[model samples]
Target chain A: MADVAQQILLSEIAFSYRSQNARVLDIDRLSIDAGEQVAFIGATGAGKTTLLRLIDGRLFGWTGRAEVLGRTLSPRRAAPRNWNANIGFVFQEYALIERSTVYQNVRNGRLGRTHSALSLVGLFSDRDETAVTEAINDVGLSDLADQRVDQLSGGQRQRVAVARCLAQEPKVLIADEPVSSLDPTSAEKVLDLVRACAEARGATLLISSHQPKLVAQYVDRVVGLKEGQIAFDTPAGAVTPEQLGSLYGWHVADTAARSA
Target chain B: MTSEQRISQQRRRVADWSGFMVTVTVGVLVVWAWVATDIDTGRLADSGGRIGAFLGRMFPPDWSVLPTVIDGSLETFHIALLGTIASIVLSLVLGVLAARTVTPPFIHMPLKWLLAAIRAIPLILVAMLMVGAVGLGPLPGILAIAFHSTGMLAKFYAEAIEGIPAGSLAALDSAGATWLQKLRFGAWPLIAPDLVRDTLFRFELNIRESLVLGLVGAGGIGFYIQTYVRTFQYDKAATLTIVVVIFVVLIELVNHVVRAALK
Candidate 1:
């Protein structure tokens, strides 16, 4: 064990789906310290989700030297179950079991920690139940805890997704385009909840978003990606207009005119 | 006329022509079928009196045969119940195997063909074959129902399984859920209502079909229908027919209640 502060480190990583010829991710190096918050900003197909999935250990079949949470990850095999439990992924589109109640969906996050057979039969330890309840409370969904997810509004559903991840007691939280479908007000609320949850646990947070300005406020550093490569990596406040223009292929004046 | 007006007029003309052609085609088909079956309006009119005579014979449904009708009805119910249970067990396995999401194309494609083949074989034909092989009884009827119903029920089950959202299962995978846990919490909850509704519908069909199994000596109220009609015991046959209609209606009502409760 290195006993180092770097929670995630990747070098010479490249990945592309076998069915498609185009490369989706090609990164030379990236590192994040433990408990640091980072945002990946890119347009669609810029590999933001792919990179986040890679760090979350949910993606495989890549050539890479990637170390996450002091352990080396294999490109061929999935990360171990316990290692997966230590990281929470809030997927885009909520990805909830729509027929299940909010409490059941959040309780599902404790599956890795519970006895497999016991959990299958709907038996959970008191600690697991408490954690699920607390996670639901943290997301301010205690009243809707028993309500089915399909009946919820988009914003409330996203909160349930965050609550599910929070129940994992993860050391690293990865949210992939968490607020893409939400309105501006709801988007900020979800972002705030995700960041606050990570901060409360002293967990590393990695969020991918197309809205760089909004996401930059929650994360300390922003990495701008274009066509599977890093265009710029800078402090959140230091992201330049030129970098944004190069990344999106639109000048600031054009953007201003379009908005006006 | 303007170009747009000309275009709209042409479109309307094409629609009218197609509609006119369809009506002519249907008229021709109806006349062809009428000629092929032979003109029988006079005979059909005369048959009304025969129908009345038949009704007169069945009017006083033999109350003495009530005990026999009840016994046969109970046997029919049991056969349907057992057959439905057996088909459910078989469908659970075949349905998962045939689900495109659960199995590869080669595997699911062949299993789906097998289910379709099973469905194509009529239930009565299957019951007849069962009787020839296993001899006369409810056992053969149950086996026939199970075999015949698996075709439709398994396909329905496969469709239900495929209808589950893939993203929900992936979310469970990211949560570190094992394959079985994903099935229990992710796939099962998402598909449970669909599976229940499908099973209930299949059960209803099974009940209706099983009623006719006894005609093939497979054991049910249908045996009484065959025997009474053959022996010219029209009143007794009428009693059995009435019982069957009541049973089918009751099953339909129960299915409706179950479906509503699921909602």
Candidate 2:
């Protein structure tokens, strides 16, 4: 291990679905350093999710050399055992197990780190239980810990998802449209939580969003994708209106007008 | 054209009320054909008096015969429970294999077809075949129920697994979860309630099926019903029928409780 640096590096990565004749994602190179809060902004279907999947190590059978932390990425790299302990993911739909209690769902973040067979048998160590409770509290969901996820509002469910990620105590947090389902206020709250948690843990945060305004508001750097390739890599303040227009084309004016 | 004329024209193009009406008509026709073939309303009317008389005889349910029927009903429950257990375990594996989200088409399609073939065989025939092959006992009944249940359970389980949000599995995969780990964390949690509810529902169905299996000498209350009816002991026959109904209703209640807990 090369000093266990907090960075993700990808080079010559390409991915495509079985049904897709053309590649959905093709990246020549990309890197995010330790503790960097990077936001990916792109038009719809611009391979934002695909790139996230590449970093997350979900897409296989792709031509690529990537590394997260000190581990090298390979087609033969086994599905991550203890990957959850190092990387946390928040999904667009929240993805909290609907049938599980909020506590159980949050506790799942620790699943990669927790002792095996014990959690499977529905038993958790006292330390694990405390971690779960603290995670729920961190997300401001202590009152709803016992509630089933299906009963929760969209915002609450998103919090539960955050709590799940929090429990993992990960080194990197990757969120894929984490608040696209929420109202504006709730979206802001989720973004705030993501920022706070990422900063508190000194963890690298990589979030993908279609909303450039939100990304500009919270993220340190912005990486724009257009047609499955990097369009711009710049500091959040440096992402000018012209760059935004080039990234989204004619829709940038519509987005700016709507924001106005 | 007037606004009303334009609106009506658009409605004519967009609203397929005629198609809806045709679907309803076809559905009614199909149902009518089925009823005409399988049901004899006139014969039912003629036999209503005898049925009423039979009901009168079945009154008080011969509670003294309860002990005799209890053992068989318990046997039926045991058979269903064991069969459900076996089917649930097998279905989990087969269902994952058949699920397109979990497996490649080359694997999923064939597993799906295999389950469909299993489902195509009627449960009674399966029981009969088991009885023929394994000799007359609850074991054959259990085997029959398991086989029939494997098909139904696998089909439903595959659908349940498929219904899971792809995002969670993607997240798990990204997190480096092995296929089994992905299933354990991402897929299993989402589908557990559905699996439990479906298994309970299947168990209820199997209980009824075990009765049918009794005709093939698979020991249960159905065997007693067949024996009493054949021996012309109408009283014992009525007693067995009442017992079976009560048993089914109780199982249904239990199923409801299990579903509630799972939910």
Candidate 3:
């Protein structure tokens, strides 16, 4: 019963590239109950992206026990297609098919749910189309649904990415630096949309970002990382400036200057 | 002068020497080719008169062979069409097998070398062998074109597959797309235009090569050219030549339209 409530649980996770001796991720333990919205804040090379990839079930060759949505992940083999559909990932680069229309790209997210043979020949049920339409409308791109993704603005492209992920109806949503390339205004809008959508669907949300102050305002929990290890895990807005400064290796004077 | 100036002077001297060597090599190669190939300026001058006589005979082409010319030309066009279609099918399979992004190096590397070896064989040589094995006709011509063009078409397709941004496929994979779905959604759209362009280019080349296949009795308008020229029926050969020119121009026009539409 306890496992039923836990959306993600990890223990004794340690990972490193084959060519590197230093571990890239060494989290001792992590647990997130269903519907919890969390953010991972770190500087560059802090393994935030790698950790998100691991939780998304894409990263391989790591030593760890990971359970997401009550299914334990095998380190050697890839996750099953249904399991993958259950955990949608939003890439930092959006990763939309530039030549495809927004509606088509969003429809791709429904592939795992459709009949494989039918989808191969571009056939989809009405349910799939309905989900795709709803996702596009939810992202406020219903008018631009027929337009090619390459013509869209960066913010619109990210919104399309969100729509694609939303179409999956995932139980746990993971975004890796989804707003890193956007302007501040767009970033806030995207972040607000992501959190709001997660809340609307009652899905567990996990996002990684470098902007701690800005990101903390979105998620209820913030887990700060420093060189592949968790430095602090506290409630959002409860993370002190000194803690963030130290996590990013800022001197006391630098922190004082930033506070001023 | 400073050491820096000395180094600059040395580099300039090296560059000048390399340029001189390259020019000298090219000149020597040209002279060697002319002498080794036994090209004679006097014989070339004498041949102009014979060529003029040949052209005079071909001026009023025999229209009596129009039916034969039309039939042979259609055969050639059919051979090219079938060969291009067959090559496209083979290229799709071989191309994916040879793409480094699709398959590991151990699989794709050997396949690449095999494709290169196929490309190295001349089309005429392949056609000759096909005629020997298949007992001549359009079958040999079709087989030869299919075999010969796959070398280039597959390589072009492999390059097209490799040109896709890796992240696009990875994104699909993360979204739980099956292997075929990833290919359909991720690889297909990005490479469809490139594949069409390559296939059209190969089709044009196949048309040209199939024209000559008839010289070896593999079947095409080239057979009439061979027979008429060998039998000294220059008037008939001239008619076949004109029809061949029209066919080639028509194909080129269609190819241009298709490529434009793709764009």
Report candidate 2's interface RMSD in Å: 2.5
Task: Give the higher-TM-score candidate: 1 or 2.
Answer: 1
Query: What would the per-residue lDDT of candidate 3 be over residues B19-125, giving only the tens digit for each residue?
Result: 99999999999999989999889998999999999999998999999999999999999999999899999999999999998899999999999999999999999
For residues B1-263, write the lDDT of model 1, one tens digit per residue: 99999999999999999999999999999999999999989998989989999889998988889888989999998999999899999999999999999999999999999999999999999999999999999999999999999999999999999998887887888888999999999988988898899989988998888888988999998888889999988998888888888888998999999999999
TM-score of each: 0.95, 0.84, 0.92
- Give the Å error, residue A21, model 3: 2.0
Q: What's the best-to-worst order under DockQ?
A: 1, 3, 2
lDDT, candidate 2, B136-221, per-residue tens? 98999888888999999999999998899877666555444455556676778788878888888888888887887788887777
lDDT of each residue in A136-248, candidate 2, tens digit only: 88899989888989998999999999888888888889999988889999999999999998899898999999999886788989999998889899999888777788877
Specify the CAPRI tier of model 2. Answer: acceptable
C-alpha RMSD by candidate, in order: 2.5, 4.2, 2.9
Off by over 4 Å in 2: A1-6, A21-23, A123-127, A251-260, B1-67, B175-181
Top TM-score prediction, candidate number: 1
Please write out the lDDT profile of model 3 over residues A58-110, one tens digit for every residue: 88999979988888988888888898888888889998888899998999899
Of the two candidates 1 and 2, the one with more favorable lDDT, higher being better, is 1
